[model samples]
Target: MGENRIQQNEMSRRSFIVGAAAGTAGLAAAGLFSGCSAQPNTSTDNAEKTNSPTIPEEFTDGVYLTKAISMHGPINVKTVIADGAISEVTVLNNRESYVIGEAAINSMPQRILDSQCIDVDCVTGATLTSMAIQNAVSEAITLAGGDPGNFKGYQSPEPKEADVERECDVAIMGAGMAGLMAAWKLAENGKSVMVFEKMPYVGGCMPITSTAWNAQDTIIQKAWGTEQIFEAWSSVEAQLQSYREGRIEPDNPYYNPDMPFITPMFDAARDATDMMINIGVGFCPISDWPAPQLAPGAFSIGGKFCLDIVKNYLTYQLGVEIITEAPVTELVTNEGAVTGLVAKGADGTVYHIASKAVMLASGGYISNNELMEQYQPDELKFPLMGPPWATGDGLLLGQEAGAALETMDQGVTSHYSGAVSHAEISYIHYVCPGVVVNGSGARFVSENMEYKQALRVFKDQPTTDFYWVFDEVSRQGMVPSGNSYRLDYTFLLETGDATEAGNYQELAEKLNLPDLTATLDAVNECARNGAVDEFGNEKLRAMLLDGNMYAIKVTPTPYIAQGGLKVDPACHVQKEDGTPIAGLYAAGDVVGSVENRDGAMYRIGLTQAIAYGLIAGETMSAEL
Candidate 1:
């Protein structure tokens, strides 16, 4: 139940597992014990009498391994017991997202050891990983001949308060990708920087990000043989067209025609990519979807890799300070210029850090229901896919310091067909060659329309209820391709959100679409004759005429708010009069209008965060 005991147990468990597996047959022949079984023996009854097994005091001592399935994949844990006491727990393997899983992986094992039980509290914002870890530990305890239900963990002593004040050149709220990158840039230039993150872990939403950065002509794109496809002028024109056609909100109050931020940001993105590469970030070719013309020169990498590089370089190489589990509650402003902020540590200790400048990269308010209702009432009804920590803390802090917000009515709403979960949707795969219908069972729009257009169409549906109808062939094609991170078909089917029928009539009946039969017949006739549907989608018209059909319930989930505190090109929070708020800068989802580039044509958010973070860092370093 101590740190030393846990460490010893971990080492013992590894050795025991290796030895046991090596001599499995010999041990069985000698009748020393039964074959290795990961399942726990729950025959013992206790006061709680829960389904979980109760650890008996006279149980044997040994090492045990068990596997538990999590949201992403299986997690394997090894538990060691010594003299009938739970000694240690070790996570052998896990495939959970780094953003949500890393903290749990690092802390849960220790907590289990300290408590001498498997019922420790889970890491917040990481429910799946926490549950999986706890489950694996429970099995391991049972296998180690201990009753998990009866074992009482140690009671942790209350934390003592410490003087945690610090003075720095810059104080950043949030240790996300943007904040970390900015801290690195500033600290590298000989400035003292402190970054505070509310979460016990860093990375924010970066781990869930697409990890695709956009630029004009870049070295990677040139090497990939797709440089000629990305023309700067044409890309801008396409964005303008999207705005002009009202595909994006044309009534954006933050739209500044004279100061087109996209042009400058795109130009700097090339340098950002180069910087990333110099720092050892790797990339794969971007997926050629929505036409390569519209897709900027983009490449994919795991956001965790980028975050790890920035965190290590800033903390070890540049000496930037990062404190996690410290939430900044208020901005301490003096005169007309912003000065510093106050943050609270996990143990309720306050730290008032003074600084010459502050950057609000604490992400958007997608998860804040109050702010969502205040800014975007319509979108508040939908499920949110953004990080849980994006509770508008930065916006509130910036606004309290007299910064102006813009385009508050807009957000990034994605249309995907399935039950809501943490898994990333396969938009490109699901949107191809399918028939979308409303609650009334009537086809609403062309399935092959641009993603934004499809979202708009789905948003306008009655009750916002829709489904994607596809045949077996289409479903087979929907399987994630090589190295694609989208959810696989098997997983989707297992969620029970997708339904299948032998024929169109059965499918329609199952979906309660009274007119689905006739609709399918008409669609089939068009596909048979190679004709375009009413929505002018020839690609969709060529499919939906064959084999077993299916319908996936579709919903538009809010990913990130496209509007936040308005900022200038230098990433300075600006007032309505177009004047910058002195000493206060914003980046990432906290500063909006960047996502509305070319009228919200749907560019990569991660790229904008990195590019603008670098800009903010450089600007603050020079100006402050």
Candidate 2:
């Protein structure tokens, strides 16, 4: 952790501008890093795009440049084969996710070099990058006219176990937005903190960010007017109504009349913002936050990079120790009160960490398919976003320690994706508000409905498979730019995720949507006339063109889990009887809102975790 603290922070994706002409990866193509001539990455589809190129029967000793698609895009590796053996491997180009994929990028080359083996065990939690490197190596071998099978079966070194025993005033699980903020506060309050993260990286699920949070009286809000706070509360008033009517969870906000549940969250969000700003972090007012934004207000921490400011402060200035790839397995309690925890390091070593108190900030259950099937069955069909480690570790740990659950039935969905399966390169239709048709070939909801509302409409349909019908002119560009949200036609076309036809009717036939021809014609008519049609969508002005049309398969994916460990206002893990478990606490997506257990939901950026995390830290600091 000490050795990697600087490296991982330096390579965080939010502000991943590692300068130098010596830069590898995509920088070489742009001549920004390796000073090579810029070779534009094209979108030419190859019919025989197998996992690896054809393996040659004969040996040819030479450096082979080969590319394999990674989590985000292609990974180009420069392979040196000397005397029919792989001598060296260097990553040439890739926009692979940082933080999560940083370890695989930094270590795989050396590991391959050490063993002359292309099939190494993937770095845990970075399977996509690891797989890409292995495939790229295989392709390189094939290009060098060498049989890729010769490079198989890497014999890794024997595992060794070293159990570590450590003590801290407060031990936090998961070094994400919540855990980090809690650690920062605890350290500031003069507590020694130890943070254990399961992933090789520190950033949580939305490593890029969790979208903008609406704070009431932050400096940005001061500049943008704080009246939006009233609007935000008013927006949730309906949810409050559902709670009162016993339609949702039984968490009545009016239970404590003296302490109306909304204000503390707003104040905490504002203070959390100020906390970051005080540490040299900045903010930007997001006028165009995605739909269903906190009414009248939205903002983020100067983009995703601002989080590193707090991460660095906790690990360096505050001396909080963060052990990455150490998954906390169980809570070590004594006499019915929480005491500490037991964990396992990535190396198979045991970590018995003793602390005065524990905070479970180990993120959500989105990556856990079983939990999804149990809690949110309808969302089970959708693809999951974020790393595979978001399996509700905190929730499991809390349950083992006798904690109750809450909001197990609610969760939010991501943008309606046409082609997010390939390295998260999105389809332009989601943004363009293009012609969307369900499996039945009929337009369902308005294309421009609020993000989640539209997702529900599509997700509830008989089939999860949907399509985005667009013309050749609508085929957008590449995923070369680090922003994954931007459309990448090259990826879609090459992967055949987007199929083309001479016209709309042909495209419909190819996609097997029987009624798409009529749907497409009606949509075209509405767009050409700029008329609000059946769905009342005024934004459908971009009519579908006739020549060489494309239809990309589309569907909504699971964004994050809703249900988690139940906790009270003070961030304490609560029992079914509403009694707080001493020395036990939780924050982040591991628990929904601390104000109530009304629902598992889509909370805006940072504030959800930061608010409860700070409260947990301060409360623990005071109680202990």
Candidate 3:
């Protein structure tokens, strides 16, 4: 099963007890006497005495819930209107159903605060806990002598103006595959859609990124196959065959979608061969050559053209409105419902649109320095490679409306062991002979294993630090399998950060290797025997040949933020105590990721982003 499905099912029953206890405590202290109106007298004093406002060890300095309130029965509770805004209810405990509690708590506060006190529906499976929290908070507020008649505890942000007031059924926040796919679906259904992008162009980290879609493809035979094409495509055909069989299940480490997904890649490749077609704003054909010549035989079968071409054709020819240089700011809520949003223009003006629902398709927080510290403080020290605009605006907007954050600790960043400021221009080679050493300068794993497997061994190693040691032979040229593992030679040669020595002894000395001779002996032994001593893999033996050598230090980097407005599968942001926030939903990377931080799955992050965006958009559009 996928990581998400497992998590959804694994939420223990203890969460229900915690939520129930908290609600009971809130009611007893408020002296509501089972649905009776709370009095502003000594009952609150007794309650306060029983439930002192002391911070628990788990929620030291952060904002946390300290109470839960439950009603006698499931009540169609109208949002508490206070000061023209809806009310917010914070759950003090974890006594409700796991997924339901989280989803409801995350959604309720925002809905109450935004709607200014109106009736809102409860999330499925969490209605009892939701009512308990809502009624208790209501009584608690009344006991405190606060105005409960007006949207009680919600505050609207100061209003801002927009540079453009264009109208669309859906306004996407990013132009990446997820956002683009959303626009395509909505547009295909005859719904007007607008895509806002912060980058100068489209393709959020995909154009230059090397990854395969996870799908199943049917093998096809072409009658006009040329020798050159056959030679170049044979390896790819074999790989695809492996994918078609049970060798590639959804959770497999090397699962790549073969059928429907690969079809797009091939289509994209074919489109690339013609006069570069316009896919979206700011995209062009990367090459104008025949498919077979793009790369050597089967090894050259990277279906870049397939995805790019389909992406381009849909954006340009399909009626998807993609507007670059726009960033969303405040969300517009009325009567505890999210109706639209306001985006900021490059000229410093705010633009507003009133849609039936809004989807947060913005990327993650890898690019935001402050957001990085708030969510993943340990990663702030490393060099970042994700796009510069992923500063957690989506998170901030959702939070402002009472959504709870989660995860805050899951991302897949390039791990180069050598001391370099930027990512290597090419993919790290799995076969290239190199020494994998921990921060203690000890060879910990086979240098020839898969990158994911190798890195997993070193993740919890002291300080999460490691380095890749290699000779010049493996670094200077293309190894077998069409992979260029070489670090930028010019950068290495010019900078000298990559140690240079005529022999292994000098290279070992510079790297502070404990035993230079032993490391060399192991490399040669592994090469001669066609096996890696630490991890047995034939692919490694072929790649690590003789070399002068290089070593690059790598520190762990977080590419995704796991925390943000907790939401249900339907994308409704929930409160801390299991109530739905009215009029708000979250999608894409800003929400808690479906994958665990250390799981072994291919395209997990991107796949979830696409799936959530797709589901959220469709749901919101259906509401329209």
Candidate 4:
């Protein structure tokens, strides 16, 4: 970890990079966006790339080093030039998110070498990393006494044609939370399981994850010396009543008026803790909180890392088969039941995988703009917060396999989608005792309220910008319980995304908010008295009198476009007539979950991935 480690080596799950982080961080640390100023050589020199271009004789056979831009920072690369041809391009160091970064770094060099062109498409869902690699190579070319722009437009070598055929007891689409979950259970039950992910990486939207979510009497809980805690599904009855009143189609069969719970969701919610633990996704309980929700370690081992643990356990220990960068293009059906799928691999190999059961967990359609504009307005689309690979392939596959769609427009579960920076800095700082004031510098909603409700409250206001204002004491009190998933507030200050002032008047002038001084006094008055304020908020009980008062701007961005294929309690992809599609199952974001109004985080969204994944895997295991 101290040096630039190769990607093929065993990776450490711990947070912080040491070795490569030291390499080009000086240049990168100068400014957040200044590091990526080196532009691509777009001279269009031989745009057709037919004739082979000769290497400049000035270039000697030697190694060259250069730096390029990555998602978070800079990537140092070593380029090998031998025998008058650019040979190997090795990424010396970077600190990108593991999955997507791996795909681009591991493959792009060989891809360029094969094609022999500086002009090539970056890996899907990995634009920044891909550019970083190519740009590093371009710099190396310049350093080798040659025009870097000359590397483009060479006739590309043709890929060897190949095809692969396989048979498995279960074939799972997507290597995300739900698919990997299903693979774990199926493999454990001695079933031959194969998981295919279209993206070059394993984790789908999970790489952008935060919570460990809703576990009751699991091992982690036991170690915390806490008894089993039941998560109150307060919104279930309301959702059920709404469904009963109008939401359900006449043919929909999942609803039973006498049933106390939304059966599949409830059953899955209860098992989530044990299921995650069993899958080897590790975490700890929220401090002093009695709820079963876990706070997964952020920035390092939080969302995608948790899934990576599950993926590693599934593939290495449980013997689950996962093929990345291979997209299942179509479903092969026989007499109205899906029997298999056809996929194309990254190496131009066709994969015909035949299976007894197919589980569709390819995730939501947030990344697909055409599908997104259908359900949401351009202004409200929190598209960037979504994992770039969630292109709704599974939904399309389900539709092809005769599944009904519902709630496609309602999937933006959180009112504020995700991240101030869509790239590596999406994680917001901890939701602490703070005041989010509008442009006029007045607290609009209760600081402790959920984002879904917060956005609703703010919509009536006339301002576009919102600032999270808090004192030094309040920030320090909350830092120990920080989630790196939120953008670092300190980093925000360094990057000028936030402003800090020693006092209220200074802070007000810096942000051009004239009313901030009055706002703080009223808040301090309420805090000193230890009573509810006008907004009925007790969360603002912290006085803003500490050193270095801070204000970080926050925006409600686009995230997961929720609502998708409707499924029964059994995890079956339901048809319009409320009938099950034989040999087909769906889980995760592709299927809608039990509705909730508390602005629940992982409760409804992630629960579907866990619960339905478990149910579908178990059901398929029992059948086969």
Which candidate has the top score in TM-score? Answer: 2
Compared with the true structure, what per-residue lDDT tens digits does model 1 show for residues 374-457? 676665444555566888999988988999987676555554535423244446344335677888789878776645335555
Candidate numbers sorted by lDDT from highest down: 1, 2, 4, 3
The C-alpha TM-scores of every prediction are 0.78, 0.80, 0.56, 0.74
Between prediction 1 and prediction 4, the one with superior TM-score is: 1
Reference-based TM-score, model 4 = 0.74
Between candidates 3 and 4, which one is better according to lDDT?
4
* Sort by TM-score, top down from the best: 2, 1, 4, 3
Q: Could you give candidate 2's per-residue lDDT for residues 1-624 as a string of tens digits?
A: 222432342243212111111122221122212222344435334322322244345776666666665555556777787886878889877666545666788899988888888887788877767777777777666555667788889876775788888888999999887888788888999999999998777767534443456455565555555354344333334334433444333354324433343345556766777787678775544344312222112212233355567778887899999998889998999988899998888787888988899999998876665676668766555655545777878888898888999867555546544343334533354433467788878988876655544556766788877887766555543332422343334655644457889988888788888998888778778878889988888877654556878777766755666667877777889887888887899888888544334332344535677677777888888888
* Candidate that would win on lDDT: 1
**lDDT score at residue 524, model 4, on the 0-100 scale:** 82
Please list the residue runs of candidate 1 whose C-alpha ends up more than 4 Å from where it truly belongs after superposition.
Answer: 1-95, 135-157, 225-259, 286-301, 347-349, 415-417, 420-423, 426-433, 449-455, 477-489, 541-546, 597-602
lDDT of 4 by residue, 1-624 (tens): 211221111122011122222223212111211222244445555432322122335865557666654555556777776776778877888656655676788888888887767678778987767777777777566555567667887564466658888999988888877887788778889999999888877766555444544434445655665433333322333334544565444443344444322444545655656666666666654454433443355443366557667777888988998998788898889999999888888788888989998989898876666676676543342224456667789998899899988765443644342123223333332444568788889877777665633444555577767787777765653333453334333434433445778877888889998888889888888888888988788756655554678777766654566568877666777899999888898888877554421122223466557766777888889987
TM-score of 3: 0.56
Which one wins by TM-score: 2 or 4? 2
Which regions in candidate 4 have their CA more than 4 angstroms from the true location?
1-95, 101-121, 132-158, 227-263, 266-281, 289-296, 299-309, 316-319, 378-383, 409-411, 414-432, 452-463, 474-488, 542-547, 596-604
Worst 10 residues of 4 by lDDT: 6-15
lDDT of 4: 0.64
Q: For each predicted model, how many residue pairs clash, with residues at least 3 apart or on different chains?
A: 3, 3, 81, 14
